[model samples]
Target: MSSRDPSLSPTLRLRARGALANETGRFETERREAFDDGWDLPEEERLLRTEVRIERPRSALTYNRSPDLPFDRSVNPYRGCEHGCIYCFARPSHAYLNLSPGLDFETRLIARPGIAAVLERELRARSYRAAPIALGTNTDPYQPIEATHRLMREILEVLAAFRHPVAITTKGTLIERDLDLLAPMAAEGLLRVGLSVTTLDPNLSRRLEPRAPSPARRLQTIRRLAEAGVPVRAMIAPVIPGLTDSELDRLLAATAGAGAVAASWIVLRLPREVAPLLRAWAEEHYPDRAAKMLARIREIHGGRDYDPAFGKRMRGEGIWADLIARRFRLAAARHGLDRAQPPLRSDLFRPPPRPGDQLSLL
Candidate 1:
């Protein structure tokens, strides 16, 4: 990567990151940008290193009543996913922490080491009701940093001990490492996993997701999980228009052949700060088709970059959106993956016993 290169060229220097700029977030007191001081002195090109801060927890589960979502509760073990997918809808969340949704959203991470304990306590509450808690909703729970932090593992342990149900969505192959814990829960219908496979093309995957696992690797993960008796859903998430739209049928066939029991799709969404970042990335990477690709997105979102309406958010309305949906449905049906993954069972939930607790003489 050359320092003299254009400011928006991330690959020319920053390597695998997806953001085109390191602009400050919206909540910052002031905006800051670098400028040449006219000194021709040599300077080292500092590569952005991932910085992780420990977040002590006050609460573990975040509850929402969004009609658009399937689950009402979720727990994000980490903030600012390192996967660095340029089109991540979660990018704007970094701004609430006074961090940039650009590079900062990928390089600067927050790990919650104490969330498991907090979650255990919360689940033990008298008012608590059993429901499948979602993971990797905002940020991938099994992101690269999870390898060392192991917070996800700890949380899984708590859930397993309590026989609690969990639904996980991720593109990380590291999930294979937790088979020991997951296999048993899977036997009891307490878990399901959604593996996002954006595109079947490896080169396009690297440019779009950067640090995320290759598309083939995600399919392999789905196979492994399915073989383990765990329910697996192949998610063709944020399906980029013009770029990946043509590959939808191939994706369904591949994932179905790889043992994906169900398939789902979400159109590319560029909400908040994610819009400009994706536009810049497109300009830097796919200069020729960038405009056409963006135009397709506009057609899906009613002539705008995005439409956040509840029913319209996940799958936009329009001819283009309908075409993609129709294609997915037809392909999925042909591949025997027309149905959605079944919800995990919550009836088996039982809180773990605490010291000094009364013994049940069942």
Candidate 2:
């Protein structure tokens, strides 16, 4: 059987593609159906191919007032993430486009090629105030498709030209390709990167985040970025309760060994449609632990699958949450990864020259 064939595994037999099912979006007024003939198809024929659609949005920057987040402004060059992570909190966002939060969220992606120009215009606005704009905040800017479209690179060039500060969070090793630009930005204290490392076990990583870089590759990425003078932080994001949480110390130590100067973590969050997807994934891949894992999750969230309240969202609320936090603190401190890094400098920002503007006569 082909590697992508879900029928090969008992847990994956339910999913023809990456997700368990192609659920209809909440806003979709219409529904569709598919029928499989008796004839068996080849693995290649059954494989789901990704489709990229171009989008020209009027604005590129997304502003949010959530207290749980560190930054107020973010840029998402892509609409949907190709990394088919089962626990992705951003899955619900696909509903806005009348697409399924399941398989469609990974296969049907939207690329904004004109985002760089829009960002430039916004940055050049007279009322604009300079601040560190976050990248990979909504969807990864360095997903697999980014290598072909290069929209993220174009956005980086715009930020580089204007000397705008940027903070990037991603799981793709593709960021290593832009060291030439990022290294210089790092020298000026305008760039910081966070590499999210979910688990150390290759099998678990593959089952949870199918398309993301391997744990080893991510560690190498952290090393390369740190060597390039870029501030690197290891993000142990969406720490699953009974599944991957036990490896917290090992993950932190590994990251620190890879030259990550700081660390952070967020407890697993299952908001909206993500809850059902994760529960299904857990039941399929880890049937033995599914009940216990889900019970622990609810325990942390106070009898609910998730608590959307800002303060309790990122780091749940309960004894289990406190235990995880305490463990992370000890591990981080042991590795000397508790040092606070300086914030990205926005003072170097300079508006890009507009069309028809006079050249400076220096």
Candidate 3:
């Protein structure tokens, strides 16, 4: 039996033509001659190898003009996620760097070294306006490398120094390291956080989001953040229709019980190459229900893999969509989790002191 561990980040380079098929996860080996003309590679080189490498990016902040998103500007401290969720929409982004979106997306990573300084300069610019700068909107900021790189911590330092209001979304337990910063900012209403917990089942969560913090740990994060006076919202994102959708109400109740003050959810989305990649993964893991899951996703997407319409992109249209929405509302209402989280205050923002600036003696 093939090992089904999801937490391990394995590198898989393409070995041979026709070795990869949609229906199976196992690879079969065959012998080949060195003189095969159509074979671009020699038989000796057919044995594939994977090497881990790190990429450094020049600049850090990414600006977005999409009307659908709440924040106009955001920053990503890392590129290519270590948490290999098969349904991740961001996977296709790897194609821009001339890499396959499958295994490459999980193994290949980019780290920004000077992001914190760049952010400080941008935030302190003369014309820079103060609005909440979101973190972890693309790739998770607190992924495994965060412990050593400390880019997220530096970014938070800049935000804290300038009194800039900021929001964060993450699933890594590493975020707990920054509570000292977040707790105080949250005290002044300058920060808020959302924890995206997909499912409570450890087995399912293991396969769904390989490198993310365990479900129990996420619940603990909610409890700790709430205890620290930081407004915490539990986000049940990318709800797979026939798979994890069943855990909706239970997830909400559990998170609320753990002290999450607000709740939100997004239906499963199969945009771009994610559609085919997810289908391949489903066939490998749950062959029996793969077809049914795809069908349910299409039913909500109007017979298509995805619909990128502004309002309907996040939440699809149809009876299933309506049902999920209603279920979320009822569950949140029952849990007394409907209180509106106050917006982070922007009026408190003050530019940081210039270089070599002295502490005020007054």
Candidate 4:
């Protein structure tokens, strides 16, 4: 009798997840494989389940020296995303935690409890300098689990109390729930939002980002945020050369119609495990165009699946990259999104008074 591991073969029924396999991380010394013992296990067992662990953060701000990044510091309240986008470049980061960058990256998550308190202490430090602290830089801060954890709201409360500047990027519609905090911060020039709209077609979005919000839903989110007076920038990230690249102009038009004030785009990036993961996903989902799609992706990346070079990693290199850049510039200009999002104000920052501090009456 022949046997197979059910989870090894994902099906359309898994509407809540992505990733074709739970491949072992590169750092793992011993590999693991599932075995069918012929006991006829129930099919419901095949469904993947998400698990969350709490971490007490010793530090709130993670500073990066990456030359290409717009911000130097970011705060990630959660690690391991629930929205399992098959092509996520952040997947490989899970390997650092001794976890697989595949299915495990989405199934296993970490929530930082009491992180807002830690952040408040850090901001209150006399040596601490004020800058726009970015959220959702490494992992989405507003993932579904956040609705229960309420960490994002607590952090925002701290920032609001201190009058600190912040910039957040996300695809989660749950951000709308915090308009009470966001609207006033934006009015003071202390906030901006990046709503990632990878594709306008819901079908492609379903396969590409199974657990993330739909393309239409994201457009509505942009409109909602804009109506609240918050600056919303449409982010057209990872334009898949053969798949969603053609939608660039249409995407800008749609976002503009939804009231976005600015726009940006980045070509597909397949670093580390992402290269193979996306290849397998493409073959499974788009067998007819997988080869051509991958070929063009490599062409843009200087004949490699990915080039980690700081200057070239995000936007890529060569003729195709130039062409995409030109198209984005033209589309952005036509849509009145040629400008960058307004810079957040740091001058408004004032640390909240701590307990036991001397009070003065004037």
Give me the overall lDDT of model 2. 0.89
Cα misplacement distance, residue 173 of candidate 4 (Å): 0.4
Q: Which RMSD values do the candidates have, in order? A: 2.2, 3.6, 6.3, 2.7
How much lDDT does candidate 4 score? 0.89
Against the true structure, candidate 1 has what lDDT? 0.90
TM-score, every prediction? 0.96, 0.92, 0.85, 0.94
The sequence of per-residue lDDT tens digits that candidate 1 reaches over residues 82-159 is: 999999999999999999999889999999999999999999999999999999999999999999999999999999
Which of the predicted structures, 3 or 4, would earn the higher TM-score when compared with the native? 4
Q: Please report how far candidate 1 places residue 164 from its true position, in Å.
A: 0.7
Tens digits of lDDT, candidate 3, 156-197: 998999999999998888888898999999999999998999
What are the lDDT scores of the predictions, listed in order? 0.90, 0.89, 0.78, 0.89
Please write out the lDDT profile of model 4 over residues 117-231, one tens digit for every residue: 9999899888999999999998889889999999999999999999999999999999999999999999999999999999988989988998899999999999999999999
Q: Please report, as a residue range, the 10-residue window in candidate 3 with the lowest summed lDDT.
A: 16-25
The residue ranges of model 3 lying beyond 4 angstroms of the native Cα positions read: 1-59, 356-362
Give every collision pair in model 1: 1-12, 1-13
Off by over 4 Å in 4: 1-13, 38-45, 360-362
Descending-TM-score candidate ranking: 1, 4, 2, 3
Q: lDDT tens string, model 2, 1-362?
A: 12232323222233323467667888998866554555866334245668899999799899999988999999999988888888889989999999988888998999998899999989998999999999998788899999999998999999999999999999999999999999999999999999999999998998898988899999999999999899999999989999999999999999999999999999999989988888877887888899999999999998999999989999998899999999999999999998898988999999867779997887
